[model samples]
Target: MKRKHQILTIPNLMSLFRLCLIPLIVWLYHKKEMYGLAAFTLVVSGITDVADGIVARRFNMVSNFGKAFDPVADKLTQFAMLVCLAVRFHWILVPMCLILVKEILTGILKMAVIRKTGIVEGADWHGKVTTVLLYITIFLHLAWYEIPDVWSIALTALCTAMMLISFILYGIRNLKLLKNRKY
Candidate 1:
């Protein structure tokens, strides 16, 4: 598939909007009494994430820039939020670290795929599911402010499992693509 080089599409703009919301979310989250505000900002962030995807698909505005840029924005947002939460909830580190590792390995594989096949692979369903679950798990902690420990542990386990599954699937896909690359 030919890559769309367009950078100014609405979907891309919304992804940029999500990136812009991160520091604000983190700042509000750190404030002693601003959990609600922080949660609201996170909701806004998640909404924009969903909106961008819809706008991209419905309007045919998907772009090479967006395919790569959107996930970066998401990981940044997730990383910042996870760090903020880890200050109070140490268990947050589990998924946070797994995400860091998954992303690093995925990045290396993506570079290999691009070098060998000359294409950037777009995210598939497993990735989408993992992202959605991550957001939901994070948002739950942010929004509830008093989320019980049991719920926290369960959500973290679920999120970590999803990440692991996605990580393995992505590894397989990237390797398969590289193996099948034409000279």
Candidate 2:
């Protein structure tokens, strides 16, 4: 059975499209004063994120490229959103930096593991939960203008804590894999 490694699969396409939306989202948020439209675009990007995963799994269109590209798109979008919001809410930089460091470390670990074991680890529950919480937090900041500043700060801090926990969990899991290596 030949596996499709093509870059133009449905899921890959959707992921690419999601990447494309980031600049538009940023522009809408910053230049156009279109918070509502920017938020809608973000929601659409999230939908595409979920849809791509489901379509890839259901249709057996998963590839190594998809495995890699999907998360890149996700992280890029999340980072962009946080940065954009940080312009308004400076405290958001805390979580933004945390998540960015976590991603960089995890990405390095993933590359090492794949080089040694050829295993590409998928998203764990903790990571998924963190991502969802991040999206919700961003959405709230974008849409709920009535939310108090204190509440927004609290939410971002909570998300940052979760992001740290997820990073630690992933580190533990990957470290164990490395320890078990038969070298």
Candidate 3:
């Protein structure tokens, strides 16, 4: 059994810090009319989210609690930011819906795989790239103060493509792993 202290290590604590920043970001975006600053905050939080995983892995601190909490933290930040943006920008629904569906379905599949295989691969490389692209797209969209011209649209399209492709890749990888399992 894992020790209780391990569950609250520095990397996991950083993940939790990201979670705590979500509400402030949303509030700044909505109430304070500070989309750019909010977007910046989100970008910082995203970096921390990614960093936590690296820290956990580099230090061999991986644990069930961290595994479970990391994805939840990521999805919470994604959902919160997307939902907030969706409320103001209806056009965001397409990508937001795709993200939400992918997250929810994959989450369920991951749990089943864990139950059966007694292991999960965590987030793959494609998944990490997709997340970075999503963040870039979101930042571009939220840069309302001085919206970039054609590049924003291009990045949005690129982000959507990456997201869909990543979803497909993750599904295929996980399905293959599941199929190969003896249990």
Candidate 4:
């Protein structure tokens, strides 16, 4: 009955629920042209994500499944939004590309490192902040229903910078971990 094995519990099911909403959000955005509804869906999904994590921690429900599924759900939600926005705006493709590349590379690197070293990667504070900023930036775009003006650009730039910083921090942390290992 170790904690890591409870990956298929209720909280994880809730996390899966959030992942299931991505298609509905995208459908609202593209077919119905309901940006407001899409934003609302995003907000709901985000809240559920936070709730699932909190529930898992508070109730001692941490499981390997939760760890894996949480990030996968998060990536799916964000990537779904990115694809929808990029298709609609076309101008955001560059930044979206950068973000996706960073995420994918980081994921691959994490897996390889974990396999070699037996250390699981957890989301650090900076990574969490970057995720929050990304959600905010996309939410604002949905709110505005157009290319954001100067303020949004500034905020997006700030968020992107934070994302990069978090990326560097994760890399450094892993390097230190490797140095300390007996391998």
Predicted model with the maximum lDDT = 2
- My TM-score estimates for the predictions, one after another, are 0.93, 0.94, 0.87, 0.89
In model 1, state the lDDT of residue 75: 88
After superposition, the stretches of candidate 3 with alpha carbons farther than 4 Å from their true spots are 1-6
Candidate 2: deviation at residue 68, Å? 1.5
- Candidate 2 ranges beyond 4 A from true positions: none
Per-residue CA lDDT of candidate 3, range 84-167, in tens?
866655656777888889988887777777887887567778887877887777776676645554665566677678889988
Per-residue lDDT of 173 in model 4: 75
In angstroms, give how far residue 161 of model 4 lies from its true place. Answer: 1.1
Kindly list the per-residue Cα lDDT of model 4 for residues 23-103, writing each as its tens digit.
Answer: 999999899999999999999989998998898889988887787778788877877887887776665565577678777
- Ranked candidates, highest TM-score first: 2, 1, 4, 3
The top-ranked prediction according to TM-score is 2
TM-score of 1: 0.93
lDDT winner, 3 or 4 = 4
Supply candidate 2's per-residue lDDT for 90: 91
Give residue 49's error in model 4 in angstroms.
1.0
